[model samples]
Target: MLGQTAQLRYDFPFLVRTDSLSFRNVSLADAILFTLTVTLAWFISSSVCQYFRLRHFDGPLLAKISNLWLFSSVNSGRSYLDFWQVTQKYGTIARVGLNDLVTDDPAFVKHMCNVKTEYRRSSWYDGMRFNPTSNNCLSTRDEIAHSALRSKMAAGYVGRDVDNIEPKIDSNIRDFMRLLGSYADKKTPVDLGRKVQYFTLDVISDLAYGAPFGFVETDTDVYEYIQTTEKNLPMVMVVTVFPWLLTLLNSPVLKGLLPSTKDRLGFGRIMSIAKDVAAERFKLDVNDARDMLASFIRHGLTPTEAESEILLQIAAGSDTTASAIRSTMLQMCSNHDILHKLRREIASADIAGDIISDNEARKLPYLQAVIKEGLRIFPPIAGLMSKEVPPHGDTWNGVFIPGGTRVGYSIWAITRREDIWGADALEFRPERWLNNSPEKVKEMESTLDLIFSYGRWLCLGRTIALIELNKILVEVCS
Candidate 1:
C-alpha cells in the first residue's frame, strides 16, 4: 500500500500536469483567431450567395436582407396584383431581383426607352431568337440595325401605302360581325377573347404570310397556334433564369426543355410555314403587299435575310395584335358601361359606307380611351424586357443605379402609378384620357405617354393596329 501510494503520487502529479497543459487557459490571440475564422466564413458565404442570387433570378426569398435590395423587389407573382403591391412598397424605382430594377416614373421611362446607347436591349431579348436568322424589324435591338429596318417598316406601317390596306381591314371586320350573330343567338358565354384572337391571327397571317391557317374559317379550327405559344412562356422563363444550360446544348432537345418550349416550337412551326410562304413569295412578281417582310425584302433583304425577316414578321405581326385584342376585350368585359357607351358613340358615327375609310370614328373620344386603357392595364407581354445599363450606369428620379445591372420596365407597375394619374389609378376610367382638356392633352403629347414604347424604338405595327382596331370598333358599333 505504501509502495502504491508512492507510485500514485508520482503518476498523479504527471497526470495533473498533462491535464493542466491540455486545458490550458485560452490566450487572447486564440479567441481572436477563432472569431476571425468565423467572420471570414460568414463574409465568404454571403458574397457567393449574393452573386448566385443575382445570376439565377427566378425570385429568391433570401433577397429581402441583401445589400443590393433587388431581392426585396421583383419577388412576387407574374400577375398585376403582385406587381402593384411591390411598386407600392418599393416606390417607382423598385428592385425586382438582385440585378432587376423596375421604374414607373415617366422621366425614368423616358431615359430607359428613349435615351439611345445608354440602355441597350437586355440579354433576354437575345435569348428569344426563334429561328437561326433574326428578323429585321422587332428583333433588331441596336439603334443602327433598328434604324435600317425602321425606314422601310415605317413606309409599310404608316403613310398612304398603309392607308391603302383599308379594304382588307373592312373585310376582316365584316367577317367578325357576321360571326357575332352566332354569339347572340346561343347567348353562349363566348370566349370572345379567344375568338378575337382568332380573328386578328387570321387577318395578320393572311396579309403577312399570304395564307391564313384557317383560324377564322366556319369550322372554328383556330387557337392551335395560340395554345402552343401559351405552353412556351414557362419554358422561356425557365431558360432565361438558366441561360448557361441552354447555351451549352443548342440542340432541339435543349430548346425543348425551355419553359417557353411549347411557344418556341409552336411559333417555330408557324415560322416554318412562313418560310414556305416566303419561298413562294420570293418566286412571285414583286407586288404591293408589303406586310413588313416584303418591306425588308424589297429594300435590301436577300433570300437568306428575307427568310429571317419573314419569320419575324409572321410572329410579331400576329402575336402583338392578338395580345392587344385580348386585353381590349377583357377591359370591355370588366367595364360594360364603358363598352355600351363606346358602342353608342360608334353607332352615332356616319361611316360614309366604307367602315375603314373614315378617321371620324377615331376622332371619337371613347374608343381611343378604351384602347389606351386596355394597353395600360395589360401591356401584353409581362416580365422585364431587360436592358443592359451602360458602363456609366443609369440615373432614375435622381438616384444612381449602378451600371452592369440588368434594367427593366414593368407595364403593370407603370400604368398603375397613383402619383401621375391620381387616386383612381387602378380604375379603368377612359375619361382621364378622353375627357381631359385639349390643352392638357397637348401637354401630355409633349410629355408623350407612350404605352407602345417611346423614342425610335416604338412598335412599327402601331398604324396597322390602330386602323384595324378602329375598323373593328366601327363594325361592332355600326
Candidate 2:
C-alpha cells in the first residue's frame, strides 16, 4: 500500500501536465472560433443598422446593405437606363445606396441647388478632379470658394469680356463645312460623331486660347484624347461611388497611378497643352490679349487656376455641346418631317451668310423647340449630381430625411417624368414645347433648363453652349 501510494504521487505530475496540454489545445481553437463569431456579429449588426436607417425608402433589395447594386449598374454601362427604371419602379424618391437616395422631383433638385440652400456639394465631386492635388470650379465644394471662382470665370464664359466669340465659332464651322464638302465630293460616309466632336473641340479651343487645337482642320482625334476619355470615364465614374477610394487614389502611395502632365498622350497631353498656353499668356502683357485665358487672368485668377479652369472649359464645354448636337441631328434625321420643317424655317429666314447668326437661330421656333426636346430626351450629364443633407436634417416631400444622407438628382428620370412632360414624355417630340399652353410651356422650359443646373451651380458655360447650339444646328439643317 505504501509503494502504490508513492507511485501514485510520482505519476500525479505527469497526469497534470497531460491535462494542461489538452486544455491549451482546446483554448487555442476556442479563441479562433470566438474571434470569427464576433467579427461576423459585427458585420451583421452593421448591415442591420444600415438597412433600417432608410427602411422607409424603397429600393433594390441589395441596396439596403451594400452599394453593389449601384456599382453593378454603373459597371454595366447602362446606369442611365437602370437608374431611370429604378425611379419608375420605386417612385420619385428611391434608395440607390445604403445612404444614398435619388429623386426625379424637380422641386427637390431646385431646393437642393438653390443659391442659399443648406445642402452642399457631396464628396462625389472629389472624384471629378483632373489633378488629384487641385480643385477645379466643378470639383470645389467650399461654397465661398466656388462662388468666388464663379465670379472670376463668369465674364469669360459669358463672352462679356472676350472678343470675336461668335466669329471664332463660325471659323470652326467653316472648317467643318469644308470637311463635309470634301466627304460629299468623294461620296464617302462621314462619321458625324467623330467630325462633330472635332468641331466642338476646335471651337472651344479657339474661343479659349484664340487658336483652335486643329482638331477640325486635322480631321483626327489629336493625341487620342477622345479615345482615352471614353476608356477612363467608366472607371472614373466607379471611383466616385466610394469616397474612400478616391481619397486613397489621391494618397501619396497611389497618386502615382493617376494621369500626369508629363505623359505624352490622353489627358496628360491636354494638360501639357493648357500649361504651355497659360505660360505663354503669362509672358505677354495682360492687356495684349482678350481671349478667355486673358479674361481669367484679368479677374485675378492665379496662373495655376487659369490653367485648371481652361482645362475644365475644354472638357466640359466640348463633350456636352457635342452630345446635344449629335442627339439633335439623330432626331432630325430619324424624322424627316422635323428635318424638312427646320430646313424650311432656316431657308426662309433672312441670313447674310452661309453660317446663321445666334440672333437668327433664336427666332426660329421649331429649331429652338427641337434643341430643347433633344436636351430633354437625353441630358448631357446623366450622373448622380448628389448633394449632401444638412447636419440638422431636413424633410423632403414630407419625408423626414436624416442628416448625413446623400440625395442625388436622377436628371434622366426627372427629364422624362410623364407627370412633368406629359404622356409622350419619352418620345422625341419637339411639338411638346410648341403645342403646350403659355404657362405650361413656361413650366416645361424651366424644367428643361435644369439640365444646365440652377442658381449658384448654374453652368458658367451655359451661354457659350447655347451660342454653339444656336449657330451649329441652324447651319447643319440649312
Candidate 3:
C-alpha cells in the first residue's frame, strides 16, 4: 500500500505525501516557499558553525563572518592605521578578518618572521607579482622555491657587490644634486618627494640594468613608473584581503573588468626593459662583467630568471629608498635642530665631494642616528607582513592560532607603541638613538632594524638602499 502511494505521488507533478500517507497536490508557489525555507535554515546553520569555529579569537562580529569588513577597511585609504586601531579596541591578537589575526607584540612578530620559521608567507604576497605565473623571490609562496631563488640571487646583493654597484648610484646622485641645485638657483619650490623618488628610480635602474630610466637626468618620471607603482599598491592591498578578486585583477580574459590601463599592463614596460637588459647581459663576454644583471647570469640564471630578479630589485629598491629619503627630509625640515646637527656632522666629517660615499657618510654618527630615527618614525613598508601558520598550527604569546590562518604584524603600529617605545614614542627625536648606553643602543638598533625585516627574508637590497639613503642625506644636508 505504501509503495502504491509513493508511485502514485511520483506520477503526479508537485504532489506531496504527508506523514499520514495522505497525498495532496501542491502549488508551485508552495514548493518554492518550502525550498526557500530549507535553504535559509541551512545557510543560518552554516554561518553559526563558522562563527563558533573561530569563537576562540576576539574581533568585530561583522569581521568574523565576512571579509567585507576587512576589504572596506583597506579600501578606506588608512588600512594600516585602521588595523592598529583594531588592537586598541579588541586588544592584541584580534581577528581583523574572517581568517586573519593581527598582533602587535614584538615576540609574536619575531616568531612569525623567523628565518627558519614553520610559518610561510601568506597569499597576500601573491598579489604582488607582476605576472601570476612567474615566481620571484618577493611573490613566491613556496618555501623551497623562495629559498632556492634567494640563495641564487644572494651573491648580487652581498655587501661587496652592492658596494661595487655604488659608482652607478654615485653618478645618478651627481645628476640628482645638479637638478636640485638648478631648482635652488631658480629659487623654485621643489617637490623633494618627487625628486628623491626620481633619484632612487634612476639609481636602482642603473644598478639593475646598466642604465637609468633618465628620471634624474630628465628631472621627471619619464615613464610614469612611479605613478604606476602608487596606483597598484591600493589594489594590491585590496587583493590581499580579498584574494578571490585576484582573478579579475590578473586574468587577461577578464581584462575588461580591470579598473585602469596600468592594472592591465601590470609592469609590462618594466618587465620588457628587464628582459632586454637580461638578453644583453647574457650576450656579454665571460670577462666583461657589468652590474647586478651580470651577477645573476654568472650564477646560472636563465634570461627569464635574470629578468625576474632584476624586476624585483628595481621595484623593491626604488620606492622604499625613496620613502626613507622623503621621510628623513620631511622630518629634518620640520625639526631644525636635527637638520642643523646633521649638517654640522657632515661638515665635520671632512667629506671632500659634491656627493658623499656611503662609507664616509657612515662615519657621521649624528647622520646615522637621524636616518635610523626616520626609519623608525616612518617605515617605508609600514603595512602588514603576513605569514601563514604551519599546517600543524602553533601557540604564540599564550594564544593558540589555528593552522592555515593568516597572521602578521604592522611595522607602523609596532614602532609607535608607547608601551614599547616609552611615552615620547611619537616624537621625532634623532637624539633618542644617540647618547644611549651600549645595551640601550643595542635594543634600539634591534627595534629599528626590524623595519627592514627579520630572519631569512631580510631585504636583499637593504645594503644598496642604505647606501643611497645615507649618501643622499649627506649631500642634501651639506
For each candidate, the alpha-carbon lDDT, in order, equals: 0.62, 0.85, 0.77
Off by over 4 Å in 2: 1-46
In order of lDDT, best first, we have 2, 3, 1
CA lDDT for candidate 1: 0.62
Query: What lDDT, from 0 to 1, does candidate 2 have?
Result: 0.85
- Tell me each candidate's TM-score: 0.77, 0.91, 0.88
lDDT of 2 by residue, 145-246 (tens): 999999888888887888888889998899999999899999999999889999999999888777988888888899889998888888778876886787
Residues 1-478 of candidate 1: C-alpha lDDT, one tens digit per residue: 6566556657654332332333335568777887899999997687676456444333334443353333222232253455456666766666555556565566666677774547877655654555633545554567687687677556656643443366666666667776777778888666676777777877776556655666666636444567766665555554443445446556676645433323334665676666676777678666665454565556665665566655555556667677777777777777788888988887776667756464775788777777777666666656566677888865655666677677666667777766555578778777788667787656444343465677766766677777777667656544
lDDT comparison, 1 vs 3, better candidate? 3
- Judged by lDDT, which candidate is best? 2
Pairing residues by index, what is the TM-score of model 3? 0.88
How much is 353 displaced in model 2, in angstroms?
2.7
RMSD of 2: 6.3
